[model samples]
Target: MKFFARIVAVLGGALIFFVGLGTAVFKSGLLGLVICLAAGAFVWWVFAQEREEYRGNIEALNRETGLNFKEAFGSGTTSMCIDETARKLALLEQGGAKHRLFGFEEIDDWELRWTEVSRNGSLSFQNVHFTFRTTQLEMPIFKVGVNSKLNGETWSQKLRLLMA
Candidate 1:
């Protein structure tokens, strides 16, 4: 759903951009040029804002967790990190609106999980993630958002070794 929304947004922006460009080229005078420039500036501004927000969220998460993440992955609204020195894992979701932090010892079991999506009899799998099960809770972590069974298996093995 998020991906679809993003695609739609990109298409809309492209349409506006081309329309502005076409108008300027077809002798619509300064109005077309101004529209084109404005469209470009608006797009740039939106991207810059999103980047700033993402960076701020990451910095905030680091400060709140007080852990130096050695490795991080994913983008958009979710991020996964490993604080190897601290022997902890972190999952930041919803563009850092929510997060989870847990130690290796706290994980009782873990598995790579796949979510199946079906629409109009068409089947697809996505949002592959590692499911970490603790005595107190179970949650998905490291969402890669793809059908990566091999990748998941590899990570699962690595996690098993780490937990052991």
Candidate 2:
């Protein structure tokens, strides 16, 4: 649903932009075209900045964990499996070639953080951070997302229960 909303937003923005361009071209000729072009360039630049920020976040996570994003989240090529009965959590990468596993006993601590983002004095969205510890690395394992607070808390509780 979130993905669909994003797609709709992008399409709507493009439609509005083209409509504005058409109106400008019909009115001011070459000058309008130049203005429309400038607007398009500005929009492109904004999207580029957003993409860079997302990429930087992934790079930072990779650097801290010494694992590629694909290896960590599987990126649709793998699956994350948790076995509470066995007290194990595993990240199964594509082709089953490289996998990571951690026993519950190895965890030192864990935390779930919820961050709220607002715009124009109104609530916008929420970000959830799930961080856990393991003796294999100096830094903790972290997973962050823009998911519902209820779902985040539920997952956090389940994981904590398993760890306990």
Candidate 3:
């Protein structure tokens, strides 16, 4: 949906640019040139604003998704965060539940935990594994993946899920 919106926006801007240019070149007034420049400026401003908004919008999405980041993976219940546990015990007990497997953070915000395995024939440089241990005893293990690139590719399981 966002992709489609972005395409439509680009096309609309292009149409405006070309129409402005056409009027400037073919019409017989200084106002036409002014209008063309104004149109170009408008498009530039819109794009610049959109560029900044893109980050905030993405962050909003991340937070929205992250609300269930822990629940999504079943690392902990919203309640009972455990009043006090040893640091090592807490880390061991919480497991990977603190991570959201489907949020934008899961897709974009991550530090790589490199493994010794890499497939020479595959573009995938790593297998992102998330293990969530929930207080619920058994919650469906939630996991998606981030690719090694910024283009937003994901792991094999995610590819299959997308296909399904």
Candidate 4:
């Protein structure tokens, strides 16, 4: 999972850091110091860039929709976000340049599908697909792929209750 990947990344960074530190203390001097500094700087830069990009995307989404999204899902322009206070969902497109806003009562139908898939004979993993159908206007059939079925189901249930 994501947590496992983070653990692995941290361990890898630590290993590199310690190796550089050891080399600086026992063998090489300037080269090892440079390695250690680069390793730490690379990690910091990677995390900082990711955080800024995510923040920018969320801010752009909010500006495009005029709704504050506590959590946004999906990627690029094809994102799904809910404004809990407004009881509304915003489907973004064209990199937030265009969007479809729908209230709970306006969503005629929706489905959350779970499927197992594998790549290059690797272990199979579950993918959750969330889809919505409405009669008010013409819209593309966008399938939002969630990380897990539980996440998809939880969102589906929340929408179900809101629409009810």
Candidate 5:
């Protein structure tokens, strides 16, 4: 899915660039070319930033837990499941039975951090980070969109209640 999105972005950017170039040559002047260049630059910047973030995330995970996060959470499509009966949270990735389980008893603390970016009085982006305790590593469970903030807060509350 992410790969497909990247492909779409590249193709869309290229299309915009070509259209702008054609317009500049046939009808419009330098204005068309400038708009096209801006569109292409934006696409390239977005992809570059995303790549840097992935690299940083993997490096941090490796430094803290010695786990290769890129291999563990391939394509970042991890399915999260909470078992109330067992008091555990499980992460399933890559259609494999292999998973990482976090018992409520093992958690010492948890926090959900949220950030929002606004541009011209309009919300541009909102993100949430879930950080919690592990036996040996204090790693964040996930960083997701603002829509997941409520769920993350609920999960953290449940874990705290279980601990108490």
Candidate 6:
């Protein structure tokens, strides 16, 4: 499924780039090249793990959302919390399962702007920034596995499945 998603994203980016480039075949070819380059750059940035950002963070993160701090880290056993900007996330263990599950395998950015809550539901998941920030969204990487690499160092890498 994620492979299909990546294909779709690449195709969409290519379509825009080629459409812009097709215009250049008539002598605006430089602009078309630029369009394709920009699209490629954006795609790479979206999927690559900017791991340096994880430097020196807590094992048990103190997350903040539209919900306040104390409210954010409320009584949950094993749960996830996204940040206020919604660009990053952290999982919290409120004292329950001590399994080896690390974190979300998905690595792409998901943005939504159309989620509506009843405003009276139980306090569980942290509050989102907007009403729609949690609505209809998907990402490029859906499952990841930690592995020992050729260098003998363990790393978390995106899982790749081959469909016949």
Best by lDDT: 4
Candidate 5 structure quality by residue, lDDT tens digits, 1-164 = 56577778888888888888888989896977896987789688868966665556445544554443332212233434455555665554432233565666666665677776888898643456555556646454443222455665675676567567
Q: What shift in Å separates residue 81 of candidate 5 from its native position after superposition?
A: 1.2
TM-score order of candidates, top first: 4, 1, 2, 5, 3, 6
Against the true structure, whose TM-score is highest?
Answer: 4
Query: Residues 84-129, candidate 1, lDDT per residue (tens digit)?
Result: 7789877767655677887877767766677789999997767676
User: How big is the positional error of residue 36 in model 3, measured in Å on the Cα after superposition?
Assistant: 2.1
Q: How well does candidate 6 match the true structure in TM-score terms?
A: 0.28
lDDT of 4 at 35: 78
At residue 125, candidate 5 shows an lDDT of 31
TM-scores, all candidates, are 0.56, 0.44, 0.33, 0.57, 0.43, 0.28
- Against the true structure, candidate 3 reaches a TM-score of 0.33
lDDT of 2 by residue, 1-164 (tens): 43354456566657657766887768766666675676676667656654464456445544555544431222222334465556666554332334566677777776666667888889754555556667767435634342556665776676667676
lDDT of 3 by residue, 1-164 (tens): 44466557767767776777777688855766666677677668766765565435334434544421111111122111111111111111222223222222122222323234547665454554443333332342333333333322333343234323
* Candidate 6 per-residue lDDT over residues 1-164, each given as its tens digit: 44466657768877877776786786688887887788877667544522122211232233212321111221223333343333333433323122122222333232222224456674322222211112124422222111112211111111111000
lDDT of 6: 0.36
Write model 4 residue lDDT over 1-164, tens digit each, in one string.
43365556667777788889989999998878987997787667656755565567667878866778655565433667778788887776543445677776677788887767778988554656778776565764556666777777787787777666
- Best-to-worst order by lDDT is 4, 1, 5, 2, 3, 6
Positional deviation of 44 in candidate 6, in angstroms? 2.1
Residue 70 alpha-carbon offset, candidate 1, angstroms: 4.3
**What is the lDDT for 57 in model 3?**
39
Count clashes in each candidate, considering only residues at least 3 apart in sequence or on different chains. Answer: 0, 0, 1, 0, 0, 6
| Consecutive 10-residue window with the lowest summed lDDT within model 1 | 138-147
Instruction: Kindly report which residue pairs in candidate 4 clash with one another.
Output: none
Clashes by residue pair, model 5:
none
Residue pairs in clash, model 2:
none
5 versus 6: better TM-score goes to: 5
